[model samples]
Target: MTDHTPHTNHDSNRPAPDQPRASRRGVMKAIGAGAAAATLGIAGISPAAATPDVSLPTDEFVETDGTEFVIDGEPVYFNGANNFWITDDDANAATEERVDAVFDLFDELGINLVRIWAHGEAKEGELVLQPEPGVYNEAALEHHDYVIEAARERGMKLIVALVDNWDHEGGMLQYAEWADAESRYEFYTMDETREMYRNHVETILTRENSYSGLEWRDDPTIAMWELANEPRLEQDDVPNDMDDLEPPEHQEILGEWIQEMSAYIKDLDDNHLVSTGSEGHYYGHWEDDYPDDDWDGQDYLEHHSYDTIDAASFHLYPDHWGDNPADPDDRLSLHDGADYITERVEDAHNELGIPAYLGEFNVNLYDHDLETRNEFLEEWYDAADAVDCNAVIPWQVVLEDTQDHDGFQLYASDSGSIIEDYAEVVAEKSGDWDGDNGNGDEETIAVGEYNTTDTTSDGLHNDFTGDGETTHDDVTAFFENLEDDGVQDNPEAFDFAENDELGFTDVVELLRQV
Candidate 1:
């Protein structure tokens, strides 16, 4: 949060555009109609096209190997900024100017990704995406459309998160209220609330971008879809009998949601990658065993291990977690913070076999000296490099100067320059990679070669009932248990064809493995 303003991601804590050459931003446009350019252009971001037909390259879409982010067969190392306010409900020329300048600066700085919120429901204002259950405000959507179209124009990829864990901007609590559920937790449990969530997801994904004339589901500029921003709940968030649902273990509640939601996203769009958008709290490999880690009820290892989650998303907030930037002796020391980066990044790759993303990390200018802040960031960056982390984005970078004084805001003209410098250094040598994304050169593996190491109930163990090996017996078991709750919950694990669905074809592919 900006000095506890808006929504800042991670810390298990609380939680645009533009008028220049704005796109028509009409709804229901085809996904391929992005040729419609902005009427006016920003200096750094995509400006208005000189011609009516601006053909974009089809190969530009980011391809993932589940270990790295790749575009056009080459692996990519992303160093980008996060700006959530570009799509703020109250849009004016200044807001558009800010968006233009930030994107312009990021493009000039060689940063490649922008993670922003696709979810927000303001309680007091008319500017909200989903004001009520299944209802959307298109006027508010025009702002969001500008953000996407502007990025697309600039050749920038985005990691768009769907919701927030806290109630910074009318998060899950608003959904619960709309559904008449008592607790915000009902947003995940109640049938009515769950459907409402799904409706929002579909609306966001399928809605046509007014400027780009492209449906969001088909937009290649979007690199990934996050289920939520730092999704987790405090232990006090118990299930209300009003939903008439049994309760899961504190952590399992979120774990279940992550698994289902990620899988659901995968079911809808195979073109883009999806993640939990959690702060990558650990379930398996935990070092400090800090009690605060448990406060959010998130299990990083378990959450990322789900079949459809393409990468591990986590954040770094040393100051909030326990680090007192003034007192170098704080428990979440700089060194410890660096170690946090290495541990999560390495664990995600070595254990779960997916790329680990440091979704948000920052040094609050209000809390530390410029020297201390730079050193803190350098330490974490080095750790990320050493462990081969796929992507490391700071808390946020903006163009406005007044916001620079906030707890985590980093304006491009000021503290954000620090990241600009860092991104420059990482651009040339950075090379954390992705898995094979059907390059057509991969060798055919034997039936038993579908390897997996998810030992717990949270993972996708190849071994049906026992050892981590697939066999005819396991296929038979799969057939028998097709209707079982566990199989129904995680059919992707058995989907040998690698299609994003679980159906008769998946069962046939399972049989072929035998």
Candidate 2:
């Protein structure tokens, strides 16, 4: 796994001039009280008096219209960033004050969306959300709730990834360890390990917001639930080269897991969309029709085959993919990467019929300076625009104070200057697409006009009374199914437990959404 931790600076102990001066505990207290009133304040205002008289739009939720994201029944476009640290379980790793400052920067820059990690594992001395299998930390969950509410207050949407593929903050491998499995791949195939994961998913989806009085499934601030962050299986002795590795059996196992989890999340709450969170790597085996590489395998296309998956996502790292600085001669140029992204975006739209997201991308700032990075991002933005891709969230956005490296951090002085310009371009392009000329004045269609794609199963399997909608009747039927068979007749429709069957957890999932 790549070491994403920021490089330590000798002067890191000193706060930057622009860093927030508030104490972490004070900020957390404010966040818990209410995000709209407490977390939006600038320096010098008392937390009690920091409440802004802003009214956030409560009804706007994002859905898909063909290959585009429709918000409030109108096509929505965005430029976003990944701030995985916002939901940091370690209170010291990410302070509440810094979180506020980061969102403040996002608001200033017109970043409409963010991707945050919703799962963290307790291992390697790191603070984690789930300290053990089937165990959770309430304070950690509250911190995440603060992030969701805080984002909503800022008019920004979030894509919350359920877990990490890498070892950082404990991931699939940790679950396998808990199950005493020999390999991380066991997390997918082993019944005990898979159950641990299912339990975690259920815990997350059914969790009620400590602050909002709403369950996570009912929260519209969340745009989607990502299955994992760049999920890939381990290969033996291959030196962890992501682009040049093979794991045929592991691929199949992951595919099954994805289908199971995607269906499980949908059964819990059909409102929000789900993404596979694959890195969009192409494997020759996928095309060669290799034995056991069936349609249910973990190919870029097959990962989206499940009815519950609403979008395709991929990450781009031209520098890493090409081993740029190590072998500059063989590195993929900015234009080359753009061409690759354009093709993938086109394929996603043409073949899958679902929107595609450039979920993560970044040029190595260590190798390229701010100007070159800016050029790279501009070319990528242009390429995405040419194909009408749904969104582009760079590898990361961080506060100027916490930056450990020049390449990944967008808060550096030079990069911040470049991003200010890039933000304007994105805002203008998005505004034109929405027919608002960069102003927030576009009219939205009625909620009933929102287009919903066909689900995997036919005809209100969970709708119980066949009333053309999911309501209280379905809730009653859910309980009945749980009591009678411990599984829905059509497992694909109401099997939220992801245990190949259902029981009490499925009931919890149904009632929370209802």
Candidate 3:
């Protein structure tokens, strides 16, 4: 069912009256005593804080207009990088220096968001496998603390995942062993099993102490809680029950898990938004037998649209480990594909009438061609705006280990710069940066201009192409035509050429074969 709550709202956690110094000390003392910040209200806030409020809805980053994720009463445009595989089972493999550097650089790139995965083991503290005892340190908690504080300090939001369910992963195996050495985790279907997961999440949500004396439940920079990562079956698992559970029981079971946990999260921490980890378009726990499953209470409807996968959705590269689609150019284009996904996003928005998000999309920066990569992102953003997507969180941001042949970063180093850049971009496209974060005054300027025909058209919707053209007359004409006698329903039919993907020779050619 659709959430009837007003979508527009101000962040409730925004300190009213900006508490005095002595009051800050009292809040700190209470926190030190292990008091739940969710109970204290403004009396609990420090002089300067970015924590999520578990008590009030507007106190966090999750205020919505019954339709999309909103920030400070305005619709949010999440523009950030991703960091999924950063914290592996082995802490040695988890480059701390690189992680710090990555956060530093993210600030430089004008980014305002970072998506990190909390693998199953990372969540349960069991994944790390190593030579010695504790050698494989599941530094998930520590790393999460670091990212939360770092992102907040830099004015960037964090989309943190709670579980990773791709391979025969760590946490799942541990849980299975806990149930019975032979059973493959009974919780996959049991109600008690789902409740256990919910309880664990609730514990985290209610906790007031996590990162360096910081409380997660009230952190504004902490965007949303992800339920799990790509909870889907792999190629080798097709023959096994992993592809789709037998008797079609697990589909309903898993959907219930999502719904339960989603509700649990919303109830526990009304301030922050919550989402299931991005699920694959096909053969996923969410898609299997319940092909007709469609629920709407969750804040974000996340999907991982890659290039491959026999069912539906876009393609994912490098992992295209098979001999299909043998054309080299087709493969490369698919690797950097975006327009196709954009069109899909457009359709989803038009059809679903909900806030959709691209949870994770990435390529090895050092290996992928720069021009193609840039093109993909440009196309993705264009389509996102066209459809009013809630957010686009790319994978693996700011890790020092990350490198490009050209020596660049997916993240910026100066946090303020990135925040400013994002604020500017969002402001330029829409009006303001949702001012409650103390981001400053709203600037008024018509977003995109149009005309009956092309006359002095400048680059209004031409951001992705960077062709330097979005003028008044063209925009005016485009919208005018959209409102014409016969064109009432599908305003998307307007021919704003520069923003028109079908007419763009390069884009058309890119999608021609795919």
Candidate 4:
């Protein structure tokens, strides 16, 4: 497929366009497997049939059990990525082929979960899923249906974010603009705008898929419903640092909105989990009404507000959030960022007693080497693992074909790519913590004999190209084994890498130690 120049006025906040739309032939080819399965009555099989009696529950609902997510009555953990643009009209038009390609890559990387946008603001001359207040776009909704259907076919789950807090996609500010309100915070207080938002949520929850003949509320593929993407009441009109009033007076408004929206979603779809995508910010000393240093932290304020919210969601952007190294000239390291995330995870688990989600996080490639970024991710993952955080979804998973405007893209074809290694580790670690095994021990594979011509050796010692010693030749053979057999088959052999999972990092570290 050939690349096309993106529309010059395309929203800068959105991801770059995906590879030119897949051809009709490609679409049919991708769908052929699903079609064939359906013909054989094998598609969309019931959850019970897919899992063994002893396995974790595979039902439609995702519930919480004290800082852990329970699915099918068993605690579960996942590693996910945000692909917000998948449902955007400007990119792949949410076509089956494009969706299939994206899921295909995810499946290859052992990524069983994804987070996508369910709402796009109405804007003139732009692709807005909701073109106006109280209006529905059937075509855009159909695209979303395709997304759910595609995810089902791949055995993957989705986190569907209902709205954006930013104006880039017709968020709260847009709604306020429509209602002629003085500030975006009015979206919570104004009856008219509040009703409009409720109506939109109803439309989404009650939506019926044209292709699958199933209502969205009944679909098991949807892991959870996010009220909004990083919602905050502090916009330009109602900035966070205002004087004359309490520094964080907007907490009440934000809290009310989350409570209302969360209750509405729960009432509509009691089967699914719901969350407020807050950034997990803590109030400053002056902002807190009490003289005590730690009185009324944001985590305590926002997380404790709504009984209906199932989990606490937060984002981590060390560089963007100014949590980087003291010296600007020095490349940003993941060490400090990892500590910040660890603190947040500990607070959410120990303080709030709710399953915490690192919903959005990433380090820009321009500021750090790929190795450093990988190390940063490793630290964050380790922190989450220690605290038993429910899920960790990085900022994004851009495909190889897409043009990367920022260094956040994790998918690359390069042999030594750390992102590739990170994905493998995530895949492995996700399965290790089902809560069924109290020890949190991962399943290990007996390293098969490496056959030089039918090479015969076991463990990491199966160096096909060399005499008994592990050398650079073994590194070459290791990657070859990955291509042929995959990391799951010899996790111990692959454990040489960082992040506690087996991958290229092991090979790099092996060479370094020798």
| Ranking of models by TM-score | 2, 1, 4, 3
Candidate 3 lDDT tens digits, 99-196:
55555555444466677654443232233332121223324556656656666655567776665554334444344444443222354544444555
Clashing pairs in 2: 365-407
List residue ranges in candidate 3 displaced over 4 A. Answer: 1-60, 85-99, 119-143, 167-169, 181-187, 210-214, 233-250, 280-336, 364-374, 403-427, 430-514
Q: Rank the candidates by lDDT, best first.
A: 2, 1, 4, 3
Deviation from truth (RMSD, Å), model 3: 20.0
How accurate locally is residue 404 in candidate 3, as Cα lDDT from 0 to 100?
Answer: 26
The whole-model lDDT of each prediction reads 0.64, 0.64, 0.42, 0.60
lDDT of 2 by residue, 1-514 (tens): 2455634431223243232333323433223222312243423222231111111234466799888887666566767888876777556666667677778777655577899988878643234689888889887888888888788766678898987878777887787778876555666778997788788888988899988988988898889999888776644412233243355665666778898989988888888999988777654444443211332234777777678899998877766656443344554555576776887788789998999998988777777777788877777777877788788888787765665444576663545544445455554444232232222223221112221111112211333433222333444454543434323344554555455655555543433333
Instruction: For each candidate, give its TM-score against the true structure.
Output: 0.69, 0.70, 0.55, 0.68
lDDT of 1 by residue, 1-514 (tens): 3332543222211112332323224312221112212212322222221111111223367767757777765667777778776765544322556667667666655566889888777544455677667878887777777787777765567999998777777788877778776565677777887787888899999989888788888888888999988877655664554332232355777778778888888888989989888777664323344423555577888878888888889888766766464565776755578878888888888899888889998877666777777777777777887777888788876655434446676655455545555554554443322222111112222233232333212224344534323444455455445556555555555555577766545544443322
User: In candidate 3, what residue range of length 10 has the lowest lDDT sum?
Assistant: 304-313
- Model 1 gets an lDDT of 0.64
- State model 2's lDDT: 0.64
Name the regions of candidate 2 deviating beyond 4 angstroms.
6-57, 124-127, 234-248, 285-298, 325-333, 421-514
User: Lowest-scoring 10 consecutive residues by lDDT in candidate 4?
Assistant: 46-55
In candidate 3, residue 63 scores what lDDT? 49
